[model samples]
Target chain A: MPTTLIGLDGVPYGLITSYAEKGYLPNIASLIARGEIVQMESTIPDVSSTAWSSVITGANPGEHGVFGFFDIDRQTGRLCFPQFSDIHVSPFWEGKKAAAINIPQTYPARIENGLMVSGFVSPTVEKAVSPAGWLEKVRELDYRIDVDSSLAQESMEKFLDDLYAVLDSRMRLFRETRDAEKWDIYYFVFTGTDRINHFLFDAWDDESSEYHKPFVDYYRKVDECVGEILSTLKPEEKIYIHSDHGFCPLEKEFYVNRWLVEKGYLEFATDSPALITDMSPSSKAFSLDPGRIYINAKDRFPNGSVGTGDREKIKAEITEKIMRLESDSVCPVARVADGCEVFWGPVSSRGPDLVFLGRRGIDIKSLVAVDGLFGKRIFRGMHTQDDAFLIAGQKENLPSPFHVSRIASLVV
Target chain B: MEYLDYLENKSIYVIRESYARFKNMALLWSMGKDSTTLLHLCMKAFMGKIPFPVIHIDTGFKFPEMYEFRDRTARRLGLDLIVAENRLAKYRGMGPNKAGASKLECCNALKTESLQQIVAKLKIQSLLVGIRRDEHGIRAKERYFSARDESFKWNYTDQTAEPWDYYRSLERDGTHFRVHPILHMTEADIWRYISREKLEVIDLYFAKGGKRYRSIGCAPCCEPVESSASTIYEIILEIESSKTAERAGRAQDKEDAYTMQKLRSLGYM
Candidate 1:
């Protein structure tokens, strides 16, 4: 029997379960009743690229090798976005007859037998799909990989409209593809949940909020689409539903690179340093978005200063210090793990030396030239490591200590 | 980024945290792939030297090859190795082959008791274990830092929540913590790391006449699986596509669904 996986990106366990229980998502509620649902853990950095890579590879960052959206190019000492090819392991459906649609971090999709349409980070529809012939059809269907999330900053109404339009296009693509192709495994991810959550998550449960109805209404429409999709599944076939990571209310943005400068761990040669490469040779450490810290080791970076022997001490000292970081009685960092311990594989040696897991309400970011230790952002919500959910068709087969890395095994 | 570096950094962090938190801490070395990789991590964390002692529970039934590998590796790594053995059990004729002893009973007497003796002797407050969640179902529930009470009984029912790396380092009186730095790593990861770091392991892991040991323990309790993977690269390749569990060759876990849990709760590493 063919297995179908419907990914509702960024939908948290509490939000979906509560919504399903309260009659806002009847289709999902019925699905939950027929299966099992639980809180699933995301990757350490808890970003879309890392979590989705884990989902496809069925391995931790150590095995799959993608730590975050961005990584320091060891040879150049320059930061670069890790693309689909950066993932080390063979995707779960490497040899299987499969159809993957709108899955994030899968830009420049590769498929042999069936179809594929990459999700986020995909610059153009022509380059995102396999079976190149599908390009014209995808464009004709008005398919969009992701809504311009930045639009929410200027106009919430236009952003909501974009979300609905993108979701509608996604449903159209899903319906058209399901009818056009038959495969052993079929996976389609709806990224609208994430786009809406990032902007309007605060509206949740607050009936008085201006955008509350639009927020809930978006999910209601999502429920109707989910029902339409489920109606296509065979009774004997399995299905899996999950999110890459959870969403949380963002209270403040912690400028990590700026914090490093204030703490004297980092030094920028230029006052208006827009890139980490502008860091002085004496700089000890730097940070990346969603809290990844890398030591400017002499062996790795061209302008490195920290010696190999001193790297550990500095990392431990920073880890201890970052754990105590606070602002207005709120500890920004929940934990700071030494990166080496969390990842292990052939390519792991180039990962960050330290990774910070932020506390709820704090979004850890790395804008190199930011002025202060903390700032507010246009984004109202952020990603969380825990609370990302998985609703499995066959609970008996779900991997224990449930994690996103093990999600692919349930289907492939 | 390389996944190994991430795991190495995290392991190093956990190691440093344990060292900073506890007055007396030690790492349990089994000469197995997991523990040996952990020893590498410990050494890397401390900058080419482990600040704490490395304890090995010599169960007497371990393979001669393992003993050789252990001694050679300890000396090579300059480890302050302390071999813990339950001589009293050996003297009393308690063994896996003994008429009245089950494999589990023998393990408790030989391995667990030996470990307990060493812990008491050293008054160690924290122990670094190389247990991974992917090893067995029971281990999947373990936190990075887990506690055992006065009698060394693991309260598996009430584990402290370890969200991210914010591990609970505190313990009550008469309790000690078991720190797992590699709890998130998988079997495939261990082999892949072994390849990446080029760490030495016992030759028993390699295939002999189409048989290879996937996991190493007591000589009698551990069986070699049918395979032709003689090199570390081959092992990684084997692990990536292998359908069998990592511990499928070990005997104790085969006794029942809860055998490992029972053993672990009773202080077995």
Candidate 2:
């Protein structure tokens, strides 16, 4: 019997019953019927890089080194992605020959002795690995492909037309490749469902109050795609459908950074303007990036230095300040264990001496005189701290929903 | 075929969804692992072909190697690359060195403005990004299909509810949408996928002189972390035990409390 695994990005298990009942996903429902589907608990941070890493490596965030999408360099204070070369562990696929295609958040198409296709949102051809030899031959036989969006709306349609033509050709290429390649493993990814959900969510509702249509159309299309793939698959293959996490609506927006500044945990230079001209300034400063913050300890103190003793004091002070701020309802803050929940801590060398979590409905705002800092209004449609789903083959032998860490064990 | 098969399937699903739904779309490629992986997914969705153009907003301060890798990859992948720049800021000789502006403002000038101009010029109706909800507090609240108005404002309060896979697109007023294909994924899954697929990612991720890129961004703004794990296996071990955030090396995020949130609200990628 042949084995096939299908991974669905961001397919929340919570809504599967409803979607399946509505006939929006018969293929998925049938697969679930044949197999057991369970909610898989995600990592503490629940971020993609971290979660995906855990899923593939069967490890936690502490083991993957991918805490978030952007991390500060300790020495240079620059932000960057943890590259493949930076990885310190071996993934299960290291020795296995497999055809890997477009896994979001893992770039450069790193499959050996098998085909590799990149994902969406990557930079143009000028920024990706070139297809060589057999891949190039495949490209030639495929339709003309050009992935470029013009700067003008008038030319936008042309871009889409070109895109569609390429897509059609590539679909053909996929069929050809799959049929010709007699391999033990094959992998593929798609982002259309996510795109539609983000853009047209508001179009479906008669209430005209919330974003709606994009998700509906996207899933409908996904269902169709699934149907097509199912028709092409053999009975012996095992299909696994899953998502990274779940989704929710945004109720409110809170500017946590501004709240932090107001609460006094963070301080800035009074002598000079809050903004600095040089990349590396000599003045005191405080800034926020999502849930984390950074303080210029060297420039803030009179002596311009933060000693080890001072580090403890600063940590205590910052923690107390953040806790107080959380109590005051200025922002949503939570204390999480090191590898258990989302908490504030060092991200890299230049990370904020302290970190905080902005509650689900809250959006952090800074009082700094930046272009978008002030006068920013509230937003709707938010994310939630929920465990996503992982459906492996038939539901009979799946792991518990809460124990997502065990997903690798199932496959291995 | 075990874990790698699962990772590949999920990514392909996201790529196809993005292609079929949004009429006008583009991608944000920072030349980093996550975004680059997203790019690779696009090709896979189309079966070894990418249908959409890829955008790279050059802030002129990226590491020299990043640019080299960018060019080489573009040539190799046969990508339609669109380079967006903040011409006005560049003309004014603006950079991270401007003292009056906070790191947040610097990002606005270099990244936000460049992205806005590119969107306007391209008339992009939707943008496919590689952001994950687990990355940050504010990001944790984001939807798979996030909407943005004409001025690129993100109204988190009035967002539509996505009950399960039934997402609501077509905003009443927004000109574009921000799509997150990997919102539900965790940090560990990404690493696992990379390892399982043997994906070719940027070399900077590995430790250099006992340091590695915990997260990547601009040259002057991003930083690395201390680690002895130079190989992928060792790095995984370090991550499993560390307590640091991913952006610890980034300087701009430390300028204010809500720096990233503010920048994101203004359409900063």
Candidate 3:
């Protein structure tokens, strides 16, 4: 008997009920009939990097140190991602010999011994080592490599055609690898579904939209791939499928950061030419170091200088002003935290003097700085902080949160 | 079954379901941990065979290593690779430095526009991506099999009901469904699976010169964070208890509030 694990990017259990009931996903329905389904509690913020890090490390965000999608460096006042090199904990893969394919957002592109495939949004060769062995195989199969975004329209079509071919090719390669090599574990990932959702979520309706037929057709195509994999599976092999979290519809847009700026918690330079061109009375600055404000003291003040005495007074005044606006519903300004604790580094290098968190139901829009935070049209959908779903092939022998740390323990 | 077991099981089931459902689907490869891990899962689901094409959208501004890694991994995995780029934008000299367009515009031209064109050209209905709700406040509202309009706009107010273990795949008219296979697992579960499976991963994750790529992106936009942890184990430990965001190194994100949301709304992946 063989053990196989298939992970999805964002397949929520709740969303699958319709497909199963309607027989859209018969294989999955059959799996459910034979197995137990469970809900997995996700970490706070539930961001991909942090959640995935936790999954690999079997630790919490507090333990993994991957808090959000972005973080401010306490020392240099720079924003950064939590890289594997920056992590101090051990992942189960470190002890086992396995092949990993298509992991997103990971850098350096170096793995222990097994084969490796990077994901989208990753850095290029200058930023990380090239897995030439993998590249050669793909190229031999006539895979396309896009070096620039110059011929976007033409390139996109080419990309799509190539994507379909690659999926088939990769599946064939997997079968070959399984037959040619004797390995304990092997893994690969697919991201077409998530991409479709991000761009075509609105196209899956009954309306006479140009993307309607194409979206439906794509789903059917993906279904065929699922069937193909099932057909090739050994009878005794255990198959497990899952996702990081579910999707939701978006609606209203809010500029929480802009609200903070209006409240005077965050101060900007008025004299600098760049600042003059960029900053509007309604514009807001976004900082990962919540509650910390970076004040250009030298250029912001009327006398071409901001004295320490004046800076302290301004900081104090801003804190008070923000506190007063915390409960205002129209404005998304939540309570402002103390900068001294929220921001790190010397007073000069740290972020804003004040940090703000939006109240529930408020999501700051990215256009706040350029378009002025207020008065933007509302979006139809939004995200939620819900627990993700997990289903196991063998109910009794599945992994648990408490035993998460033991995943590597068992594999190694 | 334990939470981890349940997560793994669900992910595998979703992957298989996706393979079974879509006839002409492709996996979007960003060369990131999540998507890379997703590729691994596809192999596992098929017992070493990835049954779909791998698509990479080249914005022409990605870090050089990303291209190298993409080429290397695709070849090694024997994957059918498709590289998409917005030639119009590139030829027009569209880049991060453009003044009027802002970062969101830049992404639209390079990423969103390119993706839209690719999907239309390939007539791709199902696209597999590695998006996690926890990654962004707006992402939390997404559905596993989400519906999209022809123009690719996401309608949050009117969403279909999603019960347990069932999804809505067949769309009336010409609409399409977005499938997410790993919507249940968390960052911890992914790492645990990677470790347990001893999956091979990228090396930029490790620190260099007391600085590590907290997140890897374009050379001009992506920056490193100061860290002393040199090994994966050490990196994992640091991740378990950090208060930073993963995309801190990406400059576009800091351009303003809701920058990501705006880009996403405009169809930027």
Report the candidate with higher DockQ, 1 versus 2: 1
Among the numbered candidates, top DockQ falls to: 1
Q: For model 2, how does the per-residue alpha-carbon lDDT over A1-412 read when each residue is reduced to its tens digit?
A: 3344555554556566567777778887786777767776665554444556666556555445665545544444444445432433334343234454445445434444455554432322222222344555555655332233221123433533444455455456557656556545555554433323222323333335343443454466666666666677766665666666554333344454445455554444453334321223332334433344445556333323454456556556666665665333443555412221332222223224444444554434333444322233323333233647766655556546555445544444
Candidate 3: residue A258 Cα off by (Å): 1.7
In model 2, which regions exceed 4 Å deviation? A1-3, A124-131, A134-173, A198-211, A263-290, A293-306, A310-320, A323-331, A334-358, A363-380, A402-405, B1-269
TM-score of 2: 0.51
Instruction: Score chain A of each prediction against the true chain A by TM-score and list the results.
Output: 0.96, 0.73, 0.67
DockQ of each: 0.03, 0.01, 0.01
- Report the TM-score of the second chain of model 3 against its true counterpart: 0.83
- CAPRI quality level assigned to candidate 3 from its DockQ score: incorrect
Off by over 4 Å in 1: A394-401, B1-269
lDDT of 2 at A300: 34
The superposed Cα distance between candidate 1 and the true structure at residue B189, in angstroms, equals: 19
lDDT, residue A20, candidate 2:
77
TM-score, every prediction: 0.61, 0.51, 0.47
